[model samples]
Target: MGCNPLHALYLGAFLPRPPPPLPPPGGKQDRARAIEAAVMAHWRAVRDWSPSRRMIRLASPDQEQEEEKKRDLPRNVVVEAVQHLLEWGRQRDQVRGEKHRRNEEGLRPPPSSPQSPSGGSSSCPKAPCSEASQPASNSQPSSGETSEILNQESVNSSPAELDSGVSEHTNISSKEKTPSGLSNPHSQKSEITVNERFLKDYNNIECIADGGFGCVYKAHHLLDSTQYAIKKVKWAIGKEEKVTHEVEALAKLSHENIVRYYTCWTGKDIFPSEDSDSSSGEEKLHKCLFIKLELCKLTLEDWIYSEESTKNYKDDAFEKFQEILKGVAYIHEKHFIHRDLKPANIFISFQNIIKIGDFGLVTTGADDIPVKRTRKKGTKSYMAPEQVGQEYGNKVDIFPLGLIWFEMLHRFKTKSEKSKRWEDVRDGRFPPEFIKAFPTEKSIIKKLLSKEPSKRPPAAAILRMLLVHLFRSSSI
Candidate 1:
């Protein structure tokens, strides 16, 4: 997303340009102005796509055509349309060039490199600021520490919230509140609103990244004032009422390794939509929403995929991933599988702790829907066999996590081969020797990578065994 800072710079260049002159009222002038405004507005919609390109298609094209037929544009709307055209032309040119470059190069670029967090590129170092040296405290930790504590806090607070809410299953315990993060006061304010309910007894700061589905900002608590990551998701995509469900699921989830959801809020107000119209659309608006929590710095994928780190830790990314597994094990305990787990979704905090993030694709033990849906979800390369082909359960997550683990542990990238899917992982594609080192847990890993969903270990069971093994190993 930030792979090129030039994109923002280019967009900035055109932003200051004056819109085309408006025609005088009535007669052919009004009609000509109206047609021009409509065309400009349509062009702008394609230019200001959220995060990346796909969002422009969200609006009903048929609706656009119908509206175009009856456009009696006002001067203000014409100005907006012209402004959009200026911006769109610049953006389209930039994207086309980048696409050309990518085609020439064999590999595609990673989204949003650290150098350019706002969809730009910079020659910045991978380690922006060194790890904060404050001793781990009870109240809140650094971004990395916050990741570990978030789930713990969620588990702790879940009981009270769940008591009043309607739920599909009663098996969930109330003891699941993810810990709150502490945000730096010096950070900039986020464009998106952080619900006061979620910010209760906590501190928050400016948002750094806003993707298509959600936005990420830095925040902290009032008590500790430690900085953490706050993610608010756009609710206008499909389901309106499901925002609370996401927040609740986050509230009940806790694990030292898994990124935690501190609190969530959904209310009617002016909010940003994922498919907001660039032209003739006001920014300070709202519809419905939900927010999640965690503490993180960057992702393992960012570290590995970036040219910034290519000269640095290409060899040592494996050990970094093992640390990630420790956290993944923690999440599996509650029987929740992070279906959308990936490098970008995984975050590192101030403490350099690995926290699994993005529970949008999470699936639970209770769902009876054949484990697989027709629509494919999750990252392509890291996807499990069942996720790619058949229906599945929690084990689907384990496969990708394991691939991430393998990449991080071995510091090896998964070679893209047309036929090398998860189904064929057993035959040298994913060597058995990788899992053989950990005797007791090796079976679990193998089962997790199994072609058959029924053969894999449940998240809860995996959590217990890994924690026990990690503890036993640490004690020795």
Candidate 2:
């Protein structure tokens, strides 16, 4: 029976590609199957294309009109169906997470195990400052140690990630069908047998940092001796689209204050596996991705502990922070919320300019929707009040940047001094000298660290206020 489609052909192809036309005339059974396959393959090339793109591709205007005749279902209904399916998956994942949590909680403590005697634990595992209501403990660790504690979350290729305006499955024609990256267990400090060709690409590789995903190395480009940071990770086979999307999204971000992303490529069997007995030799030859980025002299963490933070450099730090803010403003403008913003992620170039790096934990930004996020997404000590598995917004990044601002401006003579004042400053309690000197900036930082995400001004607004402050100061 021949059925006519409902009148929404353009919208139908958006949520998913509509079915292709009936196979061309072919009498043989195998011939019909091949024809049908070819028709579907033709449609695949046009999948997810916009209406304008689809129209441009059609040789005759009536082609789409004829195509519309084949679909019987309403376009709105198809959209609804996709939304329902997405929601169902979300709920299913939540159910599984709850079950796993219960199982872990119900496990009886072993003798001599360090499980708390009271059997009371925060919902966030290993979270030193998970609860917003509770007072911060005096024994909080440095940001570097917190990074190590939360490194477990670093391995996840996709953790409730939501991005817009980027295609996950962008066709890398030459490399699409080829094999890339390694087996999962390769991040365990295992022996790496890098290809001789790969070695020739770089020189003087030094391990700068390591996490669950793998290591970030500082290397000199063999061709020009230009220093760069190369982040290595197993090519996430199942989630290559998401991985590629992450790379593509950041690559569009072209700002001097933000770290420059040079390129990303798959190293097919270039990093050979060392483990022999566990898997076949062919499996060991999987690929890995090498992300080349601009290398800088040191991090904001190293800057905080320096003597320059004491007295004379307060104005200089403020100026430098404005540059950092510009970078963050650009990021937010492009709709990327840096979920794991902290001092260590902010790099100080050899020229003394601050550049933001480590886009390893970005989520959807500047959105009005409030949705549940992955619980273990950030370093605990620097996490926003709403970041403990609750619905949050772009202000989560603002909170940590407030902390960074305070660290850069304040005079912390020792580790003991920093620990003693961490909570007080975090809560907007400013020292008399600080309040006297930088009252305007203090108020700005206070608003940035506000408990409510809505209360924090967007980066653009803050930059405007900073300019006004500078203008008034110069006139005075």
Candidate 3:
């Protein structure tokens, strides 16, 4: 018995470690290889295919010649191509949404229980149980089409699927259930369905600032989970017209320094149902009479003036000032003048990126021709000499920038001379001592704050001078 126990102990010590678990049968690697093979097969299937059936080449002049060569695709290849493209698009959208959400940093939350922008009723085909209702009869076909296009352009799909329960009832099947009983081929349209929960949360946002133009609010988009400083034009005819003009102008213009116009939304009445009798039943509907914008932080003016900023973030203010000039430089390069280039109109993002905002006073035309104006625009202090009917053009824009720069550099000047111009000071009425006190590259400041608008440097020249000065100053 003693010999048997000793032998067992020796056997346990001599065990072969179970052959190292047989490398887990290599299942994961095999699965990975299978997936890669399947992907390569799919790529091979679609690799040589052109993006569209009607591929146009610059060299091909004759339409018939172009049509002669078929793509030589597999049967129903177009459908397959479209389906794959859509799926890829969906994946891309998902990625973008995720990136955007992450960037938002929890400023906005997901919508709770989605409801239609109009109401619970689906009078809008996009809404649930809604019938085919035309937009206001007074609305021109052109306007209606434009609105539809804008709406289509603005709507974004979520990274994740909309609550799965509601997703099935959304697109094709919903169309089939409409009261018309006949499907209009052209009638199926994609629309921006602003969930009520989203709109309420967005609209309830705090007012960041208010001005003659409108009230700006810090609103968030629930879908992408992004925040924006929304400038809401007061719901009035004149203000509304200005909003349209700004939109039209910005649509035609693109520049890095200039604030980007994202999308505009306006409300229109949906006609009451002919079959239903609710004439005086107090039916009410509203579309989002709002514009979506890239959310930005406060303007530089507040930062410069704030005591906390003065102590902690003085250098940041100066850096932001340079960004403002870059923005102005871009405007000038485009041959457009931001007639309003004051600190109030310059917006600073959280990342410290600066952009020129408030296009209400911008003008585009030849240098010789006066910037046509029906009425005076801009704050009093920042208005250039030419803006006050002094034959202003591109140079007029830079004057305000110079004054703003002065304001940022020298906080000694108690109040901005916005109510008047350089001429007002040079003419011995407003006191040149105050104007001369502006701390800057002296030569540039002199030219920028020149009495004659024509004598002042154009925005480009000013920008170059300022850029050089900034570079030199930073090096020192």
Candidate 4:
């Protein structure tokens, strides 16, 4: 007969309890011991709870095999799952550590040099990284200390190495010692030099012109005593990319009719010191872009309207117009459109050569396709009808060319005539007097001022026609 339930309960209470769970496996040896204890306990429980002979006889080989398979399956799956989770955790920690390191590096102050007995920071006198390699945290250098380090490195190393190292650090101290008379009150003159060669090559900077973008200064070269125009653009925070793009476009272009591009310089300067009475301290930095260009005697607008330009120089004027056409045609050939082709932007050298300047409004694309622009650009008086409202092609330049030609020919005696001329061109009317004086020019003007862009001739064709006229006039 089965044991009474009360007796079974009393026996179970007396039986030894399983050992407290082994302290979580410390090492390989501990883990092995814990696993062994678990297996032994399981075997002992099975042994103590003996089954009847009939039960043992009914348990077949197939049933034992199935039990073994079930036991093995969980062990393998659990081991693999644990390993995968451990690996994932390790990778996550590594990624987080890398990000933390970078953040620390960015926040760390520039390494400073040791102070000398004289109360000034000692110079490196050797390589820059001699101390840099040691560690940045160990030394907390002031801006003057860092500047001294760079100056020392520049003296010891090649110019190329100096440039590469210094350009990477935006807060480099300026080396300029002398004060300039033209310094702006809002901006401090920091001696931080970019392309020191440029500074040494050119001197005596005088402001020649100022525009929406920047100021132009007339500078003379020390070597050849040649004059050049240096455009100084104060760097605006978000407009850096635009300035870079303009520089890239100018760099790529190489034509006699296009303004020559010189080297570009970019660097930071301290805003003019606010405290006149106080000694030097850290000041806010301002970035600037300096573009050097060929100097021109005057713009087309200056030449055309000057009091001394009144004498009949029709042949000279036509020749100048021909040069302008050549420049425009060259620009079109290079797959670029000079959207702002007004008199102010057309520069004339002392040699009387016409060159297209101010490529700020230039655009590039295939000649056959019209570039769509919503915002109006170029001078209002010179804008093509399509440019004013619709998508325009390279032919938009032709309309402005017509206006330029009219101005060259009529020599608008008064402001009213200038206004009336604009009205006539906008209305597609050629002044009868102009038509009668130069019939051939009138025909050319009529086609250029066509209201429909497709009706206007390409710059290349206009150049060819102008060349033919030049040949005829010269031969006569």
Candidate 5:
């Protein structure tokens, strides 16, 4: 049988080989199972601690007997407890190793230093052949060319960067964010192309996402060498109203919390369609709108599910929520409504600023209410109760803000926890345990999610309530 590592520290301090514990029935797993409630509680405390921190509390040769009495953990219980910590260390090390490997392979490009203010170009990865004009056929850089570009980037990088193992990408999925703050890190899974004209000014075009509307690409500006998110949307030649409404909404609103809109242009672009008859006819060009947008680090949706959630959470939800409210307030003040306000639409920038983007479903009219059939325009899960085939106003935004508040305050260990929390909070009733911890939040959540649209507080009002709550809590 293998030596119990715990025995080495506690028993083998003086002797070369530590004496083994009396073997209990059903082996290690059952011996662990057989531990009583009190012993198990101690095991849990040890299990919860980090390995380095665990070492500090462990028994030392000089103070062995005193430590044993303090712990009150039996030899057998120690064996099982130590096993748990070892497993934790192993898992942590494994994760670190994978991240290191990814860094070495696909070094994340550093964020361009802020020089041109808007461009954010400086001390960053230089784009390959920014002036190289390719033929129309080679408009979009191929996957191979992208790889070569990344390779060239690494080769051209300063020797100091290479030695320091500077990464150009952040593992947002893994919560291993870097100074570079690159989100939706590259993988060759999806093969989408960028518009030829867009490629002329923006090099290193990589598809960030593709949906029914169109695709969003992460690109580097040729002159400024700054990174930007270019959302290239497709509309049926006559059905360009959505794009128009979105542009109008964005153009009217200006706030620090809002996503920065650089510029936009319209053009016709070739798109692959199932209906196209390749052999019989030439490819058709479709109406497309390209919007140059501020490239944010990651969406709020990414932050919620990150590893820091639940117990490890940084608890910056309110701070983030405040910024969202500011942006929404400005939109409402400007006589617009973010009809589709959700975690996915909220963005976090490199400087950790909150930016609200994706105004595709924004509405301009203040008292305008869409028909019953159009109620399904926003995400169903975050949709307000009054928004269902009813005459709703700006307060429609408040309901989802309430939902987002609950999501931020509650610690959901799993996806199921998150889903269940949504169901439980509909009546303004939170779990007793949660309420005991956050006594004030339940009231705010209730006010925001009131069934009547008229009852729901405006974004500005909610901001006041939050500020008041923050002051009260800080004073306490």
Candidate 6:
């Protein structure tokens, strides 16, 4: 055996090892074979992992088919769809956060500040008549109620004053102190606490318009017995910066044709208790912004539809159009674009003055250079082609003005007709009636509505043209 050990090792190395005998073909053997097959398949899947394969593995047949269909879509289309989904998810999260916040802190109603003491004569130098000077009766609420109102009013009571340019005759009460600790003899301190006073002074609180951002209330000032409009807007979580920007822009604007911004106030809700259940009990407090603005007799749209305006359209249309141009020119002069200019945003004051309002979408230039807007904002029907989704200058405003001007010149019998006219404008077509009536204006309108923004005239040029037309028409 010892002599044969080396020979046996050599023979073992050369010989192949026999395989294990197969199990008998029975129930247990079959089951074991199936299990082994499944294990091998799973191992293969793990080794060849991919998104599509993983999806196929996890999804139902129907789901997989739907995914396959989506995969066949254009790359850009797929990317846009994904982006839309992501945006929707973000918006949903924001909405949930807003709901949670609203639940925690109840909605704050509009502030009803304490009324100013009555029994004052027309202190305003240019104050209307004695009848208009009468002070409104202040509601005699209890001391505690007054205190609560005062506390709420304190939110926006930071000392601010009306611009002296607003009204030359606006008499500032000697008691009101300026920010510099000096008495401003010209302007009165804009008191947020005086909102209740305004409510007391104004008898009627009629809601003229309701929009997504705010409500417009028509009220009359008891002191001057003059009607005014109050815009009350609800403040959203991320829109504070936009609101602030609008306020700042409006503060700087002081054109006779532009809507006068009297004052603004922010109100917050007073939550009684942190533990108060908003869901089962009462609605939560909502923060809001109140903007006091000059009252107007009618918007340009209303004026256009009014019997008086329609009857004397030929006589007054040019004058009113000139006023509109003046307002827009002033806006441009201030290096701002009245991005949302439309008939609805233009106002006809009681004095027949045309004023531009609604600076919510206004954009300003940096260092007098033109600003480019990337987003498609403003009423789509009135938007210029460049405004739809292109880099545009202030000349973009001219296009809408041209539309408004065209509208002023022609009267549409139906909304359908009006829509058709807008479509025609979009396609660079002017109404035959407008062309026949005003050939010169047609040329101007064509330039204004030009597809190329650079070709459109500046606001100053438009104003000059309007002025020339006014002069010629008046002389004729």
Local distance difference test, each candidate:
0.52, 0.63, 0.51, 0.64, 0.65, 0.62
Instruction: Supply candidate 3's per-residue lDDT for 228.
Output: 74
Candidate 3 lDDT by residue in tens digits, 1-476: 01122122234344433232233346755544443333333433332232432354434547535443342334344343334434535554654564354334422222223446754423223532121232212211243442332232122232112211111122222232212223322343222223343343343355566655655567655445578766555444545555566667677667666677787766532222321376676534433245556666777687677774666454665567667777766666666666777877777777667877878666675653565674456776677666776455677766676667656655543554433444453332333554465345445666777767677766556667766877887899
| CA RMSD of each candidate after superposition | 32.4, 27.9, 22.5, 22.6, 25.8, 32.2
Better of 5 and 6 by lDDT: 5
| Cα deviation of 42, candidate 4, in Å | 99
Model 3 spans with C-alpha error above 4 angstroms: 1-204, 234-241, 268-289, 308-318, 412-440, 470-476
RMSD after Cα superposition, model 2: 27.9
Tens digits of per-residue lDDT for model 4, 1-476: 32322233335445576654854748955664565444444433443454642354378867655554543324443343334334434443543454345344433223354456776443442345453333324122344653353333222122222322331222213221222322122233213223344465666656677666666778877666789987766688987776675567788888888899987888653323222334566555557788889999999888888874667667767878888888888888887777888888999988778988987667775684776765587778888877876577788788899888878877777878788667876666777787788888888888888888888888888878888877887799
Worst 10 residues of 3 by lDDT: 159-168
Question: What does candidate 1's lDDT look like per residue over 146-262, in tens digits?
Answer: 233222211112211122231111111212223222233223233456354544544545667776666676766566656766566656656654445456557776766667766
Looking at candidate 6, the ten consecutive residues that score lowest on lDDT are: 156-165
Cα shift from native, residue 456, model 4 (Å): 1.1
For model 2, what is the alpha-carbon lDDT of residue 442?
90
Residue pairs with backbone atoms closer than 3 Å in model 6 (clashes): 106-284, 106-285, 107-284, 107-285, 107-286, 108-285, 108-286
Per-candidate TM-scores read: 0.45, 0.54, 0.50, 0.54, 0.56, 0.55
Compute the lDDT for candidate 4.
Answer: 0.64
lDDT of 5 by residue, 1-476 (tens): 32234333434344333344554678657655544333444343443243643564564655645543554546665555555444434444544565455555544443322245665344333442232222213123344643443443222222122222342322123233323433323321222443555755666778776766677789888667799998888876666786777777777777899988888998766555432667867666677888888999999888887764445352588788899899988888887767788888899999989999998878764643433334656887888876676456777787899888777766567878767767668767788887887777888888888887777788888899989989988899
State model 5's lDDT.
0.65
Measured by lDDT, the strongest candidate is 5
**Per-residue lDDT for 248-356 in model 2, tens only?**
7678899989888988887754333234555555435556677888889888888777755455576778787898889988888888888778888999888888899
